[model samples]
Target chain A: MKAFYRWTRDLHLWLGLFLSPFLVVYAVSTILINHNATPGRDAPEETSGPVLVVVPDEEDRIRLGRDIIAQLGITGELGGVRRMPAQQKIVIPVNVPGKRQVVTVDTTTSLATVATKSPGFLSGLVYLHFAPGQHLVGISGNWFWMRLWHWMADATVYVVLFLTASGVYLWTVLKAERKVGLICLGAGAVSFVVLVCGLLF
Target chain B: MARRGLTYWNRKLHIYLGLYFLLFLWLFAVSGLILNNTHWTFVKSKPVDVRSEEPVTTPAATDDFGMAQDVMRQLDISGEIHAVNRPRPKPPHDLFFSVVRAQYFTFVQVNFDEGVANVRVRKWGFWSGFARLHTVASMSTRGQNMFRDWWMTKVWSVCVDALAIGVLAMLCGGIYMWWQIKPKRRVGIVCLSLGCVSCALFVIGLRALFT
Candidate 1:
């Protein structure tokens, strides 16, 4: 019995350490994702400028795009350019609404017209919470590492659930405080069920 | 005379609640794993295909906007028109139309003038649905069954606040308990101090990041 208790304690503590960071991230992301409930007013910084961009031949649009993004100091990855025989579309992250801004450069005239993006505080936060890109290290998606962190977070929830349950059992073992413990447990159990059922139906 | 206060009750509840919920801990863990690894699980699994065909007639005069709306109405059958996709006077007519049918939503994209169309459906998965409830959304399955939100979320939030208070009580009580037991066991004091330091660091870190 003593050995079993010791094992459970060890499992709880070590598993918790592995899972804590994930839980924190998950919890924080959950809180931040619901933007309307928590209100904050911070104006977005905007800057727009025209730089000399090279117009590539019909065949080498890809190489030309890489060159332009590199020279223009644009952040994030450059997705493939859409090139029609007559017109070529350059897609980049412009400070704007809509996910990516498509720049249509006439095959005949190289003149580029810029459209502005609608700015908001929550949208940026939502982007960060969902895509955690634009960290200090430039534009990189969280990728496999981010998924691993999320997996750990998932694991941690189970540990917490276990900890909650075991703690309740321990409370039952404490005969003197059985009445109070049972009341709290009953309340918690009822609340958990109510919430689950309420949402499910 | 010293009277034990509400802090004591809080400590009692936290420990008890934490333990009682442990049985469901595995369920949470498993569900979370399934939720996160949706790429590999049934969470994202496509339902078995069931095909039922319905015949519908197209409108006589085909303006792009009218044709697109006609297609959407036919597809939705019962949904309300939420928004219309209007293209600027351009060659490729804008391809997107939005509609809501009950809890479900669909975005229809049509070829500007060609009328070639594609549709996307949006529906939340089970675990993702639950997570939405856990965070903050007025709509949830639980509400359907119990007609009440997770009273536990409100309860647990209060309980956690109380638990935080109870932790302080436990620190004090543990010290007293240690002092009483010190004659028999000498190392408890050192262990307690280390535990206290670790907890302090956790609080400081949480405050720095969250606040």
Candidate 2:
């Protein structure tokens, strides 16, 4: 039992150390999101640049938007596309590092207007919080660095789960702070249950 | 006074950082579960009652933003006006504005060409309101509103950055402490290797299967 306690303690400590950075991102991002305290709410800077080549007979606005983006020399994953039929324009939102740029293309003239915004620091952090992972098979096309980040995020999840379990064990075994630890653990467990139940039922 | 050994300090750091992280841990765990299972009807939303007035004169064709401002002024819906949507320049293009408060949200849609304004209020239930916080990131007021924007956006962002670094330190210290326990070296390696292998396999398998 003594050896078991010692092993558990070591396990908990190492796992916590390795996984804490990712956990912090999760915790902070969750809080900021919950409070609506995310940054980057300001209007983007708009600039009318060179006209983009009009895709002949391309009715798909997303494709046209992508084409326009390529022409404008913007590099990043396509985040979203908003089509405004009334204005005969397609707005494509591109997610670049620490910034979001919008490309507006006029269907009639095939001219493009680009608007860029440096999403506030919090907003950028939030974006990092939910960045998507690249696929392992079937045309794995995301950037190499982004794929690495996605892999890290995936590994972080399992590591965190392991750490959470080990943390509970550590709390139980450490007699010196068992009472206080139990209280904190109970608070977390009860809050989780109550909140979830309140929402579900 | 006796000097403390490295292990003692390491354990102390671990304990304190763990304790400090408790509240945030709980918040994320619960909110994360909620976010993951959004398909569940855990949060219910309803349209709020809105009072409509006579339609005002249509604003100029090029000034959709100005028209939206006029609509807000007429309806007396005050808060940070967030442009929700600006449709194309065709006739009857509706301009959408959103005002988010602590408890509820006010959405105003105006058809500038038709000179019509429709206001809708969305009252969020407790769970829904709580869940909505996960999606809230706005800087409607930057420098002008220091008290609100500065504290909420800028200050909170700094906290997140610091917490990130602190977490990394905690992780590193934990591994070092574990390494010092030579007797358990074999067991530690086995367990860590198992974890890493399983994680790698799961990630690879998932990507192969899904994507």
Candidate 3:
């Protein structure tokens, strides 16, 4: 029993140390998102010279955009792809954590103009907060880094679940702290119940 | 003596806050996992649909949301008023809006001319209900970034903020306690530095590495 408790403590300490940065990202990003304030929200845009890339016949926008970006060699996740028939162009948005660059291709001339905007550091945190999100339904990430981020984010949460249980165990063993800890736990439970019921019922 | 007292209080606060936020953090973590891997067989949400029509009198309110509230009251539907739209379709329909709770989404489309509101309620099981809790603040659509009108939204948002801040506090306290263990300081520094560098590289270095 003593050995088991020691192992749990070590697991909590080491995992908590190694994953603290990722944990802080989730915490800070949630607060920033709640306030509707992320840094680099108003970063300026820069447009680059047109690069030639053929827009081939394809029904799916993401597939077509992927083909186009594959030719350009710039890496980022693709947002919704739409074509402006009047302008004879297809516009695609490519997004990384800190930057969003729009690729507009002239179906006629085959010239692609890239408009890039950097949303800065905190926006990067916010972007990482919801990368490879639940939306885009059947579509998977085309960018390597975005896909990697999905795993890292999920792994961090898994460790977090483990940490929560271990934390409770560690608290329970500290007899001097038990009274204060239970008080805090009970208060949180009641508040959580009220908030959830208020939202649902 | 003062420093000793400060250290003692810090430890107490850390333990207390950790216990307070134990279940609070657990909900977000579990729901977050469900959302992150939404394609999982058991957690994938398939909302059950029920469609009906409710008779509603034209209320005196002129604004779109006020009229939505009036219609909601008439029909006994409750949840956040996600959106309200009147495209003024040919021959005029009364109002179109959706009310969404954690477990169900009720879409209401009213026809003032006919004195009937066509209602569709799509409900989901707990797996999806918990998933819905993860995104209560993010109903913002393109061209519709209205402030959340529901009090529940405000409370939920504030709680999330508080929980996040508390976690950060506990993080600092945890590190302080580890530092007090003289033998673990070297290893702790290494682990802490690795985390900081890895996150920095992922957040800022990825674009440079890939592009």
Candidate 4:
């Protein structure tokens, strides 16, 4: 029994050390999300840009989008395209590493306006929490280095599961404080079950 | 003095829990900030290149899925098809297919009338990559062969479910420990109350202003 306790204690310590950085990031990010505390630039940058010169003969929206992106010297991947026939406009949204730009073209006049927003340091940190990983068959467009980060995040979920299990074991070993520990455990279990039920139903 | 043993065990458990989950707590707090303020420019994209080829005859297949495969083969794009959208609003019905790879996303639009497919590839940077990690969840069977796909998804999804419960346990353990530690009970109670009250007030204030 003593040896078992020793093993659990040592495993818990080592795992905690290994997961310290990830835990800190998750904790801070969660609180920020809860409070809606996000810091960023004061205002988005807005500029008027030239329109596409070579509009496709077939009026292909995608082709027209590419032409506008080229004419305006927009840098980044095309995030999305929105067409408003009533307004006679087509909006192409572009995303960069830490910024976003939207180029709106007046379909009738063929004029374009571009607006860009750069993220702040806090915003960047917040985004780290949202990194996507390769799961099942859907591979993200992130490179190996970025994919490594996602893998770490995925690994953290499993680590947390182990920690919780180890925690329960530790509580069992500490038989003297069983009452308080059991109460806390019960409360947590009830909260989890209730919340999960709420989510499902 | 009679409760010394209980106090000792409480402190031990509390310390261990703190040590174990400290970083996790911090991560959630910080990432939460980014999610709340999406307007911030944390991710930036730079237009790379546009490649095209001679227009080819429309694929014999009429369905979007089959056509998407044909487009993928023609473009030499490698990845599983994430989504295919066919908005049947008006003429010139553009067929959109989102192809995802490990390092980039290829957005393909097939214009049947024009006999052309426009391909746009987007690469995510470090911050954007990090943001993606925060939102990672269970993979749906939509684009996956459930039986043959990677087992990581099944394992990770179960872990995530346990994580929710673990977090609750951690919070409960923390509060109980705080209550049991007589030496620090007063300060702990004050801090805990302040945290709870402030959180409630802030949430209430936000709802009042936004909702």
DockQ of all models, two decimals each = 0.13, 0.08, 0.66, 0.03
Report lDDT per candidate: 0.43, 0.56, 0.83, 0.53
lDDT for each residue of candidate 4 in A88-126, tens digit (9 for 90 to 100): 888887644345578987878877888877664445444
- CA lDDT, candidate 4, residue A130: 48
Counted clashes in each candidate structure = 35, 11, 0, 69
Worst lDDT window (10 residues) for model 4 chain B?
B142-151
Q: List the candidate 4 regions with Cα displacement exceeding 4 Å.
A: A1-7, A36-38, A41-43, A46-116, A133-139, A143-145, B1-211
True lDDT of residue A65, candidate 4:
66
Q: Tens digits of per-residue lDDT for model 4 on B1-211?
A: 7578766665666645433443433333344343333445654445354545436457777877778777777777755466767333144546777764323567777777888777777766544434443433322232333121223333433434445444555555555654554765565555555544433322232223221
Query: For this target, which candidate reaches the highest lDDT against the unseen true structure?
Result: 3
Query: lDDT by residue for model 3 over A3-117, one digit each (tens)?
Result: 9998898889888999999989888988877777757867998999699997888998888999998888777888878889998999999988888889999988999999989
Model 3 C-alpha lDDT versus the unseen true structure: 0.83
lDDT string for model 1 (B1-211, tens) is 1334544554454465454443234434455455345455454533232233333344453665466557756665333344455333233534455543323445666553454455666655565544333333312221212111234344433433343343334334434433443442344444444444443333233223222
- Model 2 DockQ class: incorrect
Model 2, C-alpha of B144: deviation from truth (Å)? 6.6
> Candidate 4: lDDT of B192?
51
What is the full ranking by DockQ, best candidate first?
Answer: 3, 1, 2, 4
Show where candidate 3 strays beyond 4 Å. Answer: A56-63, A82-87, B86-92, B140-145, B208-211
Candidate 1 C-alpha lDDT tens digits along A96-187: 11122334444445544433333333343333333322122222222333333334344455666765455445455568887766665677
Error of 4 at B80 (Å): 36
Least lDDT summed over 10 consecutive residues: which range in candidate 3 chain B? B137-146
